[model samples]
Target: MVLASALLATLGLVSPVSAGASKGVELGASDTEGVTTSATPLRGTRGVSSYEGTGVPSDVTAYGAQRVPAGHRIEGYSSPTGDDFGTQSIIGADGRVRVDPTTSFPARATVLITRTVSGVERLHCTGWMFGASLVLTAGHCVFNQSTGWYTGQLRFYPGANGTTYPYGSCTAATLRSNTGWTVDGSPDADYGGASLNCSIGNTTGWYGAYWTTASLNGTSTTIQGYPGDKSQQQWIHSDQVRASNSLRLYYDNDTVGGNSGSSVHTVRADGSSGCSGRCSLAFHAYGVGSGTHNSGPRITESRFNLVIGWR
Candidate 1:
């Protein structure tokens, strides 16, 4: 899959606010609500309908970030081979596979996001339902860091399978992100939430979020999202957490450019909510560069509360 080079906008930085124990920085009251003019608009062409960047798994050469932490050793690094490493595979070569909502837990809760950059250029990203009317995603998906312009008119599709919109779609009424993203341009602050005008969450349900500092060295982490390379179809990858920090978690799941803002969670062993597992981690965003992993903004107690309030 060939991708046209994107025109990156200059990231505008603002005064950073205190973020407490997490590396995430909070924005002032004025900057915390609604889309702002300073946000980098998420970009795409009028004809461009799919994400062209590379996604998870170590060998794929996607446009997405793929840097793991320094010296982080992942378990599946032995005979690296699959889908040409970066050949636009929706699921990664080694362990990724397409998911059927009827068979996967928390799968229907994952939703697809659509928006018009600057109100003309249409683009899409991945997000998860977290409340009756709230969805969570990467801040960059709503506010581009390079462009400094907030996107316009968000449309969400829950349980989206190919051209089928099983759970229907809704337009976002509000887009909120941290001040570090719109003001300071910090990736650590790369999380955003949306309030939907429709009540899809009541039909499909949502996930509860949490954060922790305990070592997740061997914990199962699963990511499901609508990747652009797969024509905006949903896909899934399950892997173990590789490393973490104050504001991020690292894994080797197969993700791509469109998978940004996906929910990276750990499925519970006993299963609940009529599904097999649930998400208990972070929101996936960047692929580690020069590293063998993908990363997401780690959810903190405060961050959890922030999004929960929106829900």
Candidate 2:
């Protein structure tokens, strides 16, 4: 739920308990620091998923098993149209509950981001591991398109739940995103990744991404992130997909500001040998088109192939 229009100052250095955050601060990436990133558009067909996996992971250890069916769709959050999509209830507010440090595959893969804006401000966002050294997140979290500058120092805390940092923290060595996001601030192209200076993924492992042209309308989806409203602790929510186009997937999940770049995934039986039960589906980006309901850029062929190239 980043309010890029708010024109807030950028921030740096994340605290375990909302230590460096300001009151009345807007939730989203600040228009502060960011270095220009150079990336070529991954050459591939748009709107068509062209990954190598079975699309549905057979044996992912990310979650248990699939809970919903395909073609699952719902209305936007608090939509004036109707309540057919279901309502959002606070599962936890103080960031005390709804944490998943124990069943720690997806949660373990999730990471918290701290950025310094304009040399003085500090902002927070979320990301998840996609490679031994690559952490995926929202492009704006790394490059502030509004200011045409990249973030100044970027720090990542992996498997961070509450005050504990299970796998330690690392500074970003490199940040990457699509050329579109870097130039025009296209929300449809908001995905980004960070190459860390450490090997935290070797210990925690990373989730494998899957993409397909098949409908994800009814498949259950889960989103995980460290929201500013929840004291910047890791929060998890499980829900079903409401709609999907080539660019995005819509769902009703509890999300707030600071959740930009959170991973959108499907948990269930992947049926693959040694598979955990999860598949990477999308990357969360907050904005107007996203509205009140939780939505993200659906993992397309280009994004999938690019991420695989990182490995």
Candidate 3:
């Protein structure tokens, strides 16, 4: 099945939020009696309508009550021949993707991840921080056909400069990906987005950093990721990037696994603050690194807006 095909079905799926809900975290506090006493709920354009009669997977239901470890791995990799692509690399001793020296890209958000199966740690993938609590990443990085929601420890890094900054971790209580992602094994789903709330701050991590949202559509973008199977162990660099109609990214640089979910940010030609350049360009979220898809669906903000309510 073609992954992009699922996205075609998504265009008609945009639906508004449940009235007065924000992207991820609820902006206010609640009182006793299960009543929410916060101010006007942070509102946004509604997301896709909820799926009906779709229950959680049996495996997820079985393990939902248990807390898995912070480190886990999942099985399976994207087939390299088709539109989907990734490499085989094991997690390093540093609890990160083993880098390939050859590949490079402008690094933006650093992600922390853990995977589990039958309540056992199985696989892990890094994630990139987006909005205040939003994270962009590959859908497969955290989800699997057998394990369901790969939960353990989720963290983010602003910049990876060895030991200079420590790592940050958060418990991902909620997760969401494109509904079409499961329809086929396409990078189309790679342009996925997620949101996370950090209760514990890690100075060496990304939670403490500031992030601003940009608009989508025809924006100059940059990306950074860890390609464990590439020539570099931990890769970081910048390049002129473009977003495709499929919502996937097409840049001049190279990327691989572990780089999945890497954040794509808007920048100016001179590499200055804000997204506007010499032209009357407005900076905004371009697209997320879902995976390597020459012809796949791209991750759109409308879909992400839906997930924001989930967190």
Best candidate per TM-score, number? 1
Per residue, candidate 1 scores C-alpha lDDT tens digits across 1-311 of 00111111112232222112222122212111321222322222000001111111232112121222322221111222323245332234545577664213366678877765454523368888776577889998888767754535567766666555556566677888988788988888899978777665655556645554456577788888876655445778888888888788888887767788998877553323211236457889887544467888887655654664565
Return the TM-score for each candidate structure.
0.66, 0.65, 0.47
Evaluate residue 101 in candidate 3 and report its C-alpha lDDT on the 0 to 100 scale: 25
lDDT of 2 by residue, 36-100 (tens): 12122223212211112212222222222112222222111232432222123332332223575
Displacement of residue 37 (Cα, Å) in model 2 is 29
Ranking by TM-score: 1, 2, 3
What's the alpha carbon RMSD for model 3?
13.3
Could you tell me which 10 consecutive residues in candidate 2 have the lowest summed lDDT? 26-35
When summed lDDT is taken over every stretch of 10 residues in candidate 1, the lowest stretch is 45-54
- Give per-residue CA lDDT, model 3, range 1-311, as digits (tens): 11242344345442323222234212211111121322333233112211111122222213222222323223333324323233222211112323332111222235434444465532255555433345556667656566565555443433333222222234464565656564554555544445555422112112111122333344444444544342222454434434455345454334444555555444333223212222111111122233532122333443443443343
- C-alpha lDDT (0 to 100) for residue 242 of candidate 1: 85
lDDT of each: 0.59, 0.59, 0.36
Candidate 1 lDDT: 0.59
**Pairwise lDDT winner, candidates 1 and 3:** 1
